[model samples]
Target: MRKKRGIVKRRETGIKYEISRKNLHYEKALDEIIRIFETENYRDRTINDYRRNWREFFKIIGKENVFDVTREDFRKYIRQRMQMDGLAAGTVNIRLGGVKSIFSRLVKEGILTENPGKDIPKLRTDEKPIFAFSDRQLKRLFSIIDKTSVAGYRDYVAMITMLYCGLRANEIENLEISDIDFDNSVIMLPGSKNKNRKIRAVPMNRKVREELRQLIIENQENFGEDVTHVFLTTFGEPIHHGLIRKRMHKYGKDAGLIDEARVSPHSLRHTFAIRYLKNGGDIRTLQMILGHSDITTTQVYLRYNNDDIIEQYNKATENDDLNL
Candidate 1:
């Protein structure tokens, strides 16, 4: 009876099981991929990223085996991703890369005969040239920030550290009380975006250091010494990027600093790079200071030099009296 019904029946236990063709294909590829993520054997979230891609790919392919997906299907996926207007180019690339990786893994496991995305070109998401502030502008901006006020002091120190140290918003958000090393004049950046474990030793400028010390003292008196966040919101929670950005806009308005481009928390880092370069700092040095894995990224600071050069050129040619 079991043989006629296409069921695998154990002779001793009399247990019968039927495996559908689609189920067999899914078991061979999709189930194993899911298991890889659930097991946590892959420590990175890369597995989860791939799994998400697989889920979306499967939904689109609809019961088609890994071997059945053609290049046309791959192109369609890319089109779908591009149509997501709110998604950044960087994020789209990540998702696309995730999809390619899954197919490559399937090919390695012999579940897929060929990777459809093997020859497909990767998406380009190279951002525009960075725009940072000048040293004079930075100093001027800080001059207007009153450190006597509690929130003002925090804002001043936060901006200074971010600009000077080139720390990312998320990295700054994760700072702990123990991370600061006043004796060494550095603050350790833990779990950075680059996944580097080494401590980023940033030189604590005197003014910034003094403000940070007073802020800590005040916090300790109010919330005690055990509190973790270096910068806090009014309710004493950790400061968010949104709030910091709002404060920056307000300060910019107050300082009469006008630029057509919109500024955000990330602008401070760019400002630091330009200021460092303007001060005659080398590109390699700036790269290390900014925690950039690639030197090419540090090269973007050169664009800011053009503005200074143009200013100088204007002054040099203006007095020549070429108005004839």
Candidate 2:
């Protein structure tokens, strides 16, 4: 007869095991997950995030086994995360996605009988990411920099690269002199966030080309050697991200353009996309130039097509003899 408490089951094969209702399935599931990610060659950063999430989950489960974990555990995790200071809904969703991915991998590996995170829904929150700057704001930012100063020249170049070419912060920072082709007026970004390898060509607008050319000339004349990047601090080092943001904010404040809005280096890329689309650039072309993996991603800029809306409105309201 099975005992009501402190029970141990022994098999004829001399194998003894304790079968508790606690969740043990998660243990095998986590190991299988690591193997699956290793096989798939997920990015290092992604794998690190999974490991961190697994740690948090293991801590929460304590002595509980994986199979015994319920949807409630995940819900409670969400609540706990929400209670944390400075936790954004979007960020939470990403972590939740990592958790879900672990279970999914477990299911695929035949480790877990079922996926617990599958049924878990995302939390709702009202926070839209603030992106890009307006054309007027971009102009104001440029106006505050002194064209002759090293910092000013670096910033101007950075702005042009970010705004006109739509390069990411890292891409701009990593850019080498060899990345640019002065004759071709193009740049080759080896790879980026989406891991897409392609070259980007920006037909340097007259103003931007002139600014770059002048900077190059001045550097050669003053330093007796050519600089590596289109932008560099006075110390010939790459500008720090925080310094760039600070300078942008300072300029924004100086231009009296401060507002209840969030802005960053990414704003240049966003503003570029909008202006390009509004000027009738094709989605496919924009995708190639911006190194976008999908056309849908570039479509985010299409949402800001105020020019098209106004043209349509004008067309709808136009009447030659309305006054008569």
Q: What's the residue-level lDDT of 124 in candidate 2?
A: 80
Q: Poorest 10 consecutive residues of model 2 by lDDT?
A: 9-18
> Model 2 off-target regions past 4 Å?
1-41, 56-68, 83-88, 123-132, 192-203, 213-229, 318-324
TM-score of 2: 0.74
The alpha-carbon lDDT assigned to residue 189 of candidate 2 equals: 60
**Which candidate gets the maximum TM-score versus the true structure?**
2
lDDT of 2 by residue, 1-324 (tens): 876654343332122224454334454456556766777777777788898987787676463466666788887777777785457877878888888887776566554568887888887877465376766667777788776787787777777877887777767666766666677676766554334645555556666667777776766665557666656667766556567777767777877777733456778888788788777788788888877778877766767667678998899888645774
| Error in Å for residue 88 of model 1 | 5.8
92, model 1: CA deviation in Å? 2.9
Kindly list the per-residue Cα lDDT of model 1 for residues 1-324, writing each as its tens digit: 464446554343232334343223433465565564466455355566776777786676565566567788777777776775456667767777877877786666554567888887877776766656655666667788888877887888788778877766666666666777887777766543333545565566676667677777887776777778888866677877577778877887777775643355688888777877887888987887777778887787887677789999999988796675
Clashing pairs in 2: 23-65, 23-66, 23-68, 24-65, 24-66, 25-67, 26-66, 132-267
